[model samples]
Target chain A: MEASGEVRRFAHQQWPYEPNYKRVNGWQMHYVDEGVGNPVVLLHGNPAWGFLYRKFVKPLSAAGRRVIVPDMVGFGLSEKPVREQAHTLDGHIANLTGLLRQLDLRNATMVCHDWGGPTGLGFALSNSDRVRALVIMSTWAWPLPPAEFHKRIFPWRMMHAPLVGPYLLGHHNALAGRGMYLSVVDRKKFRAEAQSVYEGILPDPGSRLLTWTWPRWIPLDESARGLARFEWLERELRKSKFPTLLVWGREDEVFDHATFATRFKELLPHAEGPELVTGRHFLQEDSGEEIAGKINRFLDRIDGKQS
Target chain B: MTEIHVIENYTPEGKRRAFVLAEDRVGHYPEFREFFVRQFSLGANRLERPGYVRASSGMIYALVFIGRSGEPFPDGIEIYALPDALEPLNDSDVDADLWALLRWMIAGVGGEWRVEQLDATGRLYQLSVAANA
Candidate 1:
């Protein structure tokens, strides 16, 4: 995790792009592929990284779009696996399926959020014909129903207590300091130069052990432990017909688009929107340019280039 | 002797709701910490304290009904009592002796039970059972 030159001059003064490491499973995976066309890919979650899509990677890479975003091995400027079962969820979907098979990101367009909705729908339910579209936000694929206020939540049961989830996310980092200011709803857009590049790439406690093992791998039943891969990603995203959209945040306070946005519009019913804006739960720090102008009008109405 | 499932509902503007799902226990379940400290007195909300932490596998209550000054309990209701299972955190509202003390603590801890009700526009309702030992 060596980005110092004052963290590469504060990531070139807050993301100027042009950094792109690979080497997935041995760690060193930072990313930001930048402009071209047809590929989007931004996936971030938990105390954030991939610099939380640095404002949708330069306006969707100046509108021509080829954005890609990465940084997930242990978060931004990658490489921090001081073993906590090597931060599993099958080791972050095998480091984002080996960085989309070492960058052969075909078709694409998979922007996600919050544990990037089961690691970007478990890599689009195992590369469903190279996932052409799907925006989704807030997050949840399935299996989570048993709430009493998640055991009277205080540090979300101290991050699911296994020795106080490694002493408050590995010795007092407290989820990048107080769970990133209580998961933003604009706390003045988390200023101080984005909390100094998010508490300067995990400054201590053995690099916050993947934000203390990501809320104890939140699956919450069907006898957890990645609930059969999110119940096979809710039965293949309910027969995925692609072109999904769902962009929530109607006051999230932890994924409450009034209780999972009508179950993600009843499981992607010709998935278009659960849109409902005015944010919280880092709705990309309260609407990152109206979520990149609704992902450029959902990729120009799914390539019919909008009538 | 393991089985606990209590579910009840109402919300589409009506208000009143409930949830308690823990079944066939496995690793940690002291009868949901004695049915959530006897239906949420939780030792008088932890002796009027509101924010807490114990964790080794139990106690992390924070039912703060609002009071932010150096912040921690931002909204309200959060519990994570473990022995087998009992997890609650932010969705709010529950307490009508929480469904008769989760059916008298699953018949005073005597095995297999299921009671359901989830339909605030997401069906999966009623499935009662308690008489077993």
Candidate 2:
């Protein structure tokens, strides 16, 4: 999915980071590789792309750290597979794994948000030696059932429905349209221009399949498609003894930090925060500078500890 | 068989509290509750404190507890349903979506279970595992 002229112009104005790409699984996976030093890989989640981290790349890199933010296949400027099954958890994990191996990003700090939590942590768990530290935002790494109230929410249930999900997500781009705005606490931050950049990447119904499949892929039970892999990742993450930092937006209506922060603390007991309280689900949008500052300090502190 | 006993309490201020008592006929309440909390996006800290675990959507808050069957534990899992949380369900379509989500949660447990919604208004929403299956 190539960025349209409008998206390119928007990127030029708002996000000026150098655009880089690598062919992963026969698809052009777009990423941002900036600065120079110990690598910091940023991962994004559903309804978003690498552009989600546009604000952080420059600051983190300027602070003497390389920042690598990749748009998963089916997102941003990456090639979108026509088939829904092609966007499986394994496929995403593989694409990222290949990209990291190709770049030889060793002892890197992984900063992840939303679905990035799972995919990034999934990578960390498997490649623990390569992962020096972790910065987790609003996301989960376990396979659990949806709460009753979660079902009541229109988007969660509607996106999973057989007929309705395809129509709303694929046909209308409902998530990119109204869903993104609803997820944020500060609505003004997600202005018309931002929406245009996101919508431009997913221009048509055919390009929206990845967005449609993500919500439906939430593993509600052991029987759900990716439950086994999620279970494995969860077990590995729980046992992983890496230096970790957790930053959260208290106001996130979806993936509320109050709900999941404690679990993350329990999993990585030595992990540093449930830091940054002002933002929403997309904390990058609300508190990107604060998050980046914290990341820099976290890196320095962990490096000091090792020395 | 895993039995999930749900107890609903209403305060004088019209606030609602929900509690869950998981009794495993096969003696796996702890395991079941652990898995249950993880799946429902319930915070593990609440297991040690009197805090509420908000769902992923930040709409539902559940105060969860785990114990052996017939151990004289709290009668049920207490859920605090804020007005804003339940407000969206005012629409009939969203209400149906809620039921579908509940049904999906029930199926995830994968056992013969029964959910008895004991509300004073006689709005009994019983979720029989077999029926949901």
Candidate 3:
């Protein structure tokens, strides 16, 4: 057999909240909606899914903030057709924006993490006012990776390969559950059910192709047309006057918070800022309640949704 | 006479079930996903709205209830224990209210007053109370 198909993992931990999985763009998108008032949209990035917000979702919603989280195509509960079409960063953003449009969510507070950078901004760039505030996490929005760090995250030597390439993704666990679990060291904090929910997302190896190939679309070169629109998006992010909240995990690996911290401050100078000391690229999972508190105070302080 | 609200893990047929009270009409919350993910020490709730809990160990079991209505749920409050701090519920541990516990959780949140953890088992715990932190 070319690959194994035994990925029946369960989020053994029960969510204090229930998850509502809906169909859209030919896939099932699992999201949680709580309370009413203003809507806060959280977009996750590569190898990661909406589950990243598992920690923050509850507290935010409990505080009367409507939280919307979607696992982009090929990730989480979204159907990953192993035999079908390819997953593109641009395509993922479009599908997510479509989800928002279909739901008719207005004045949303957009929060992005990792690959979420472009996904969150792509929509905000076009509908600036609808975006109440921008929360940029450990990721980037510019075209292509800086020549210095491209190989660090998206080494073509592996992604462009024909066969073993996909295996590398699953083998790393970062490409799958092991990788995600390996990143978090605290064992007691996570219940069997919580780990089950996160790992349950990936069903097989073929479906794991999205994780293998998504990094390839980082707009590494001119041949990638996506780079153009991304360049424009980055410029818009830098100039947009919307109130922004930038939270960086000081301990992030791929996205050294130190580097992006300065970048965001320069781009959105007046934005409210908070730093997570022991945080990782997945800050919400590492410190969800704390971040939700920061968001709560931020919203109340600046009225994040007031137009 | 006070209301005797009961939560049973097993029905008469021995099938396990979740008991959500009348005020619990909201059923399951869709937005509590992350708090479960992050495992924040203490989850925040409405000014006076508290949640419910049931803890059991071996032969000893304790039904815990806490509310944030204008009055405490049934007239009791609760508290936060250290992580994985599971223990048998003793008759001595059962009290009219959960003041010490709820206060501990609020103190963790930088607040001196918030939440009431009533270690109560009775009908009074069912009646809604006046507003509280």
Candidate 4:
């Protein structure tokens, strides 16, 4: 926790974005704001901060879209609360809501992945008027059964285990350390420098709780926390006519194409694709350039229709 | 004369669960006192009252303190420790000496044991195995 500033400095070295801060809730929330035009807001999931979308910022901004990526409260340069209770599905949505309202973002294109799926969709489903399009990747907004890999690995049980969970996750930084490494298809791309940036950002046991909470938050049934909101998301998704697109990490075992991406298509029936590209769970790391191209083209199509 | 008392209970599933009180304080035993002080600096002013929590799988592991026990801590399992200020809990410092202490304490109870903050003013010190040992 003491070395957090040094870690943030190191993170900025690789992340290479001018940091912006907004006082959302009590914590100083960190975000990246670049270019000018209709806003394209990007949200990252657990164990990932705005750094995940660093590759997209330049291209998307050059394409004349404002890029805004917020490091969800618990991750990135955002001020982290030591208590796990501070991180909840509803709490995150509220924080995102606070940021958007303060920034006065409207007619935005929302890009979501991993836990970003729920956090971004949660905001979008409720604030339909403010959003224009959505690009969903390797994430879920429904309360489906645990995915196959999740079932096989049983991350839920381990993450919640008393000493074991805290030791491996909160204490040992296993999720951000080894888990992030395994999240990609090409292990070569996940170099030690990048890994340190992820691990360095969370320097202590308490700082790692956010990563630990995301897996534990996976909804198992209707009684799960944030179930009602996700239910609302599932029920409301079809009704929304916003231009939608689906993309996936071809090799993702965690939220693989068959289960997650396919389900996304089923819900957003008219959505553009279940476009499978290179990478695994953290697909953005593996195929950011290729995916950015896909996103640019998708936005162009959306712009054509609007014009 | 460690003056440690072992409290036993059954989980809802009827698994045998146990915890220890070291003279109604943490570090009543010399070994625990030495390890916590060396690793966590149990004398630090910013932190207070370190304890552990029990999980569903019947494992006791996380380090908790007064006014800060958060999620993944299941209900009903009581923790007993001498309220003592320790060094900021870090992942790297948790493995060797702390793990050795945890393994030693759990060995007495047959699998799992928890230490908790019972009151704001009371200090729960080093726990000793009164029953098994």
Point out the higher-scoring one by lDDT: 2 or 3. Answer: 2
User: Candidates 2 and 3: which is better by DockQ?
Assistant: 2
lDDT of each: 0.61, 0.65, 0.54, 0.65
lDDT of candidate 1 over A21-87, digit per residue (tens): 7778777777779899878998988778877777778888788988888878877777787655567
Q: Candidates 2 and 4: which is better by DockQ?
A: 4
RMSD per model, one decimal: 19.5, 16.0, 22.7, 11.3
Question: Model 3 off-target regions past 4 Å?
Answer: A1-12, A21-23, A146-149, A153-161, A170-174, A185-196, A304-307, B1-133
TM-score of candidate 4 chain B vs. the reference: 0.24
Better of 1 and 4 by TM-score: 4
Best by DockQ: 4
lDDT of 3 by residue, A1-307 (tens): 0124333222424444455655566655556566677899888876777667777777788888888887777777666755313566567677777788777888788988877878888888887757778888787877666334555312332222222133334322334454455445353454343455555566555566576566556666676647887788878887888888888877676567667767778878887775654576566667777777888788877674543
lDDT value, residue A74 of candidate 1: 78
Clashes in each model (backbone N, CA, C under 3 Å)? 18, 10, 36, 24
Q: How well is each residue in A1-307 modelled by candidate 2, as lDDT tens digits?
A: 2544222223457788767878777777878889999999999998899878878888899999999989888888777876665777877888888899899999899998877877888888888889999999988887774333344423364343433344446545767766676667677767644767777779976777777677766776566777888888779988888899999998876677667787789878988888866777887877778888899999999889889
- The per-model DockQ list reads 0.03, 0.02, 0.01, 0.05
Angstrom error at residue A225, model 3: 4.5
Q: Quote the chain B TM-score of every prediction.
A: 0.19, 0.32, 0.21, 0.24
Q: Residues B30-91, candidate 4, lDDT per residue (tens digit)?
A: 23334334343444632443444333222343233322244211221223322123423332
